[model samples]
Target: MQEMKAEIATKNSKKANLLDHNSLKHILDESVSEIVTSRGYAEDVRMSNVRLFIGTIIIVIALFAQFYKKKFPGNRDFLIGCIVLYIVFNVILQLISYTKEKNAIMFTYPPPGSVTSTGLVVSSKLPRFSDLYTLSIVSADPKSISAGKPVEFTKSVTQWFTKDGVLVEGLFWKDVGALIDDYAAVPKKKK
Candidate 1:
């Protein structure tokens, strides 16, 4: 884990040349893709499991109702109740999935100065819905990197996507890049 963190930090540091607006925008764009793809994929897998579990429970209840129909004359009422409950459960699941997709946050390492103990968090609102997303960066103490301790947040940066995960493609990048450049320019005290 430490090795991977070190490698990531090295790579980010190398890519800290925020003077080039194009490069910075490209990096942010790439990060958005990474965040969405990874988080979306995980959400897909989890929702699939939840759906399967719900289906299994519904089937088991149905089977029980069918097998005990003669012993329990109330089987018809019980089965109808189960069916209604199944429908309600399915609707609830759909709502849950939609909520998750809209609000899920994927944390990843940001370029240089954007680093934080919790790193960067990316989330989407889905283009068809509102075509917006929130990208939050929390600045951390450089010394925490070496100490393997949680860093303190000295600053924060928040950017939003105008269309899905894509930025407005103008001064936004410059503003964001300037902040990161300023942060990265800060000298760290040696432990």
Candidate 2:
């Protein structure tokens, strides 16, 4: 309890700078495809998990229904019951996973919240980046949207990501440099 609070306090103490026009611009330019990839990745994961659950249910039904197979002889009330249970359970689990994924994406991006917090305008001036989208660095502060502050445009690199906010276990964005440098390094991957 206290330990966790102390850790969070320590994290909040770190300074995370705002991305400069070039760095932010780079992310903005590349993000059209990245958003597509992230969205698809989330969708794929959801589908795969649902498939796995379905496969497990099928196997369980097959195994259990067999023991009851001979008992019914001509009637298949047990087998029918198993199938019904599988479908009902699958629907429930699918809804749960869908809700979980939506929460994860919203927590990480918080587009609606970030825009209001940062005071960044999407007027005609910032042309290379689209007026349709908003880009923000994760804030060092847990309680507020700390991106787009003037201080962020300078050289500071301290940023904090609450794992709960990032929402997936063992995942976080460490800093603005990591954000820009990490993605920029990807083009060098081939040959």
Candidate 3:
């Protein structure tokens, strides 16, 4: 883990330039394609599951009602109730997913000099690994790179916090690049 972190911090050869804008762009693109997109896809699958579960429940209830010759106000009311439940549950899920997406893409930048810090749990390492790389992109000159915008990716446990509850500092190269590409407020110069 430390080795990987070091590689992210300093590339032994000139092959990987972590500091360059193009590298950042690459990281951001990979993040969107791998992390963010997967998260969105998972949410979609979850929504589909909700739909399937509701449909199954509704059918089971309708079948039972018919088999038992049960009547509630009218046969229509039973189906109507099931349909209402389906809509309500699906609506709630949609609202939750939407809220998450909104929160995830918060491209916030404080005053240039102001410190924007988040803690990360490092193994036996003092305090945390500073997410300097990610935060730096956000803090750099407006002309250099676009910072604080809603992250295109979902805020997962790995992305948001560590096992011990510390907020993970820094982002994977993929996340940094993807974020800049998708959410950078100022246009980045091609180097």
- In order of appearance, the predictions have TM-scores of 0.31, 0.28, 0.26
Model 3 / residue 146 / CA error / Å = 23
Residue 169 lDDT in candidate 3 = 29
User: Rank order by TM-score, top first?
Assistant: 1, 2, 3
Kindly report which residue stretches of model 3 are placed more than 4 angstroms away from their true locations once superposed.
Answer: 1-74, 103-191
What is the alpha-carbon lDDT of model 1 when measured against the actual structure?
Answer: 0.45
* Candidate 2, pairs of clashing residues: 15-158, 16-158, 17-152, 18-152
User: Which lDDT tens digits does candidate 2 get at residues 1-191?
Assistant: 99999789667542222333343334332432244234321112444466577778867876787766466756477779887887886786677656543212212232343233322211111233332223233222335544433222222111222323221111222233344333223233466
Give the per-residue lDDT digits (tens) of candidate 1, residues 1-191: 99999787555531423333444445554654443344322222444567678778767766766676455565667777877877877787677667643443443443444333423333323223222333433322334662122211221112433222333334444544543344335466799
Between prediction 2 and prediction 3, which has the larger TM-score? 2
TM-score of 3: 0.26
Q: What value does the lDDT take at residue 127 in candidate 3?
A: 15
RMSD of every candidate to native, in Å, equals 13.7, 17.3, 15.9
Name the top lDDT candidate.
1
